[model samples]
Target: MTQSKTWSQRFESALHPAIARFNASIGFDIELIEYDLTGSVAHAKMLAKTGIITPEEGDRLVEGLEQIRQEYREGKFVPGIDAEDVHFAVERRLTELVGDVGKKLHTARSRNDQVGTDTRLYLRDRICRIREKLRDFQGILLDLAESHIETLIPGYTHLQRAQPVSLAHHLLAYFEMAQRDWERLGEIYQRVNISPLGSGALAGTTFPIDRRYTAELLGFGGVYANSLDGVSDRDFAVEFLAAASLIMVHLSRLSEEMILWASEEFGFIRLTDSCATGSSIMPQKKNPDVPELVRGKTGRVFG
Candidate 1:
């Protein structure tokens, strides 16, 4: 299938196949297609409002972008490696649908800023979902804690029993950890809510583009104060990852306790047949696979 190459004329020859594969980001960035479409619609509207592009052109661009979104949902518009990245993949398809008007969608913006805007928009949505999940998990923990209010359990320090403690108190400690994770997400959302569009690679654009208007359209709090920082700053991503790592740490710790408590030596917890796995040779074996895997996999999320 034929694909559009935005920089076809800039290079002296076609890139080597190995180099092209290395340069391609479509494999993963395709996940950002929905966010990219949202950003493009906001940008097109801002361009029209500022008299950079006519209202008719802006409407056409938005309509085409929405069509692309529908195509993606219906599994009709899949962009492979030839598209290079989600930005170009969407642009290529938009051009096919709306002709030259599609080309104007990139006016006064660079891929650098475009990707920044899309990633922030994506992260903002994900952070909200994660917060909701954390709330649900905390609710579950609260219910369990309430039911076990007076149940006694051995409190341990350094994996050695220290004293008898209420099981509800132990569960509440994890609830508190999850609460901090939720708060950290809220703080990260604030930093991610700023729009980075119109930065134009690394410098401010020459066009009289309205960055604030674009931000408002995209539901962002404001525009980045510095153009250079807007396009290049990935501190929000790093911060989110760091927060996520801590969340995983808390989860891993709880998993560790579950693993230990379910052991024959401790006998603090019993694993149901549905949640435990049986060993092939050991007829009496019932492994705590869920918590064991969770504890083992926690290291992957560490920033």
Candidate 2:
């Protein structure tokens, strides 16, 4: 086998042992493959434009990166353990594809900034998805509200029936909360859309590379001005985690009500068998296991 082929085989062999112990992100970070390729393409273009690399080399790098991207999309790409992160895995693959030209794609970039940029890009997309899911959840609540608009349900305070309320009104309350959650996610996405690609590690690159050109290429709103802030700032992740926590809280509240409604003492709602489970010994008991489990999982979500 050639040197590259040997390297590939060795890398593949090393992957399993590390992944089995550390929980390989090849499954998760693999999602960033497209963004990684895009970043490399933009960097190559910028390098050529800035006279750091020859236009021919940049074109070759871009073509190679595209080919690597297609390989990933076609399920032919395999990441390995020796590749420390998604950035390394991608660069390694690109090098394998185009020889020395692939190695130049990392010019004026660092894994710190590369990973940060990839993460921001990832979060931007995920936040949008989460917002869509929130909207769907809200729609479910709204449909429930409209259907039960006049249905009177006992409103609880401290787990006790404190007063009577329209079931619609109760459900709509969650709708409002979910809408705010959606808004929060949108707001956070704007902040996460800034590009960190030009920030090499903790400090900005000295290269005459145009950050704006790369930012525009990647569809980023703008490049981060402060290099240290760009690389170290995980506020976007924290914001996403916060939004997720709030949504989980809202879901937990809804799950709690479902659990209560499904209880024999409450007798307010009959959960579908699809959403419940029968007790092993208590053959008559149709337990609200789903909502209870969802509620139980909320604690882990918060933590």
Candidate 3:
């Protein structure tokens, strides 16, 4: 029978490096370490406050975590390839720094709920920033709308000219789309801020831990009522992705319009050199690459 190896232990048959690279998330999810460390600090404090561990141990764990955070901040945290993912990589580092007491940090939690909490923490900030940027983009569109209020453009339906319209009306329609994207992101933030820290493995822990206090420490608006749902639920992520897909759709539509407007046939607009590029073989052509890139990225986002 094969026994499970600890963090530093090698597999009985020696796991291959090629497979390790294929399964590793440390490349991208290491970005998750900031939230992961924040969650651990909250967990450690709650453990001490609730008598799950001695106050001295909790203090050590917090200090160790802060050191790890510092390492990450200073570009000094090097992840081990054998460590499965960010959670394991972090726990491995913590155990190394603070000795056995660092092992107790996972007593009342599971990587399931830990990741859920970390993703919420990470996405809460991300959604807010995306919304703010979208608002700024809307502001830019509004400026364009204001300047183009008196400018005339032909509106299209089914690739045919349908009616004459002010350029402002055409641009303002996109701002309305941006407004919806902004509001959708705001709603997503509220749902993503609930804490999932106290849900251990699949069931609630029997440690008399204070879920509410942990939630408060993490700045979560509330605690999950059902531990199973807390650990298993990813509905917030799905919603955010859906909303993001919609925003990308709006962006791609706008990009398609920009690509057409800047075309020689339409001759409706000219892109600035900073955003425009020229084809390698064509000396006279200034390509609408920025808008084209937005359109290209939309496919990857949807996928």
Best by lDDT: 1
Residue 246 lDDT in candidate 1: 91
lDDT of 2 by residue, 59-90 (tens): 99999889988888898888875454577688
Worst 10 residues of 1 by lDDT: 1-10
- By lDDT, the better pick of 1 and 3 is 1
Candidate 1: which stretches are off by over 4 Å? 1-5
Which 10-residue span in candidate 3 carries the lowest summed lDDT?
1-10
State the displacement of the C-alpha of residue 71, model 2, in Å, after optimal TM-score superposition.
2.3
Please give the RMSD to the true structure for each candidate, in Å: 1.8, 4.5, 2.5
TM-score, each model? 0.96, 0.87, 0.93
TM-score of 2: 0.87
Error of 1 at 209 (Å): 0.9
lDDT against the true structure, each candidate:
0.93, 0.83, 0.90
- How do the residues 147-170 of candidate 1 rate in per-residue lDDT, one tens digit apiece? 999999999888888999999999
Query: Model 2 residue 227 lDDT?
Result: 88
Model 1: lDDT equals 0.93
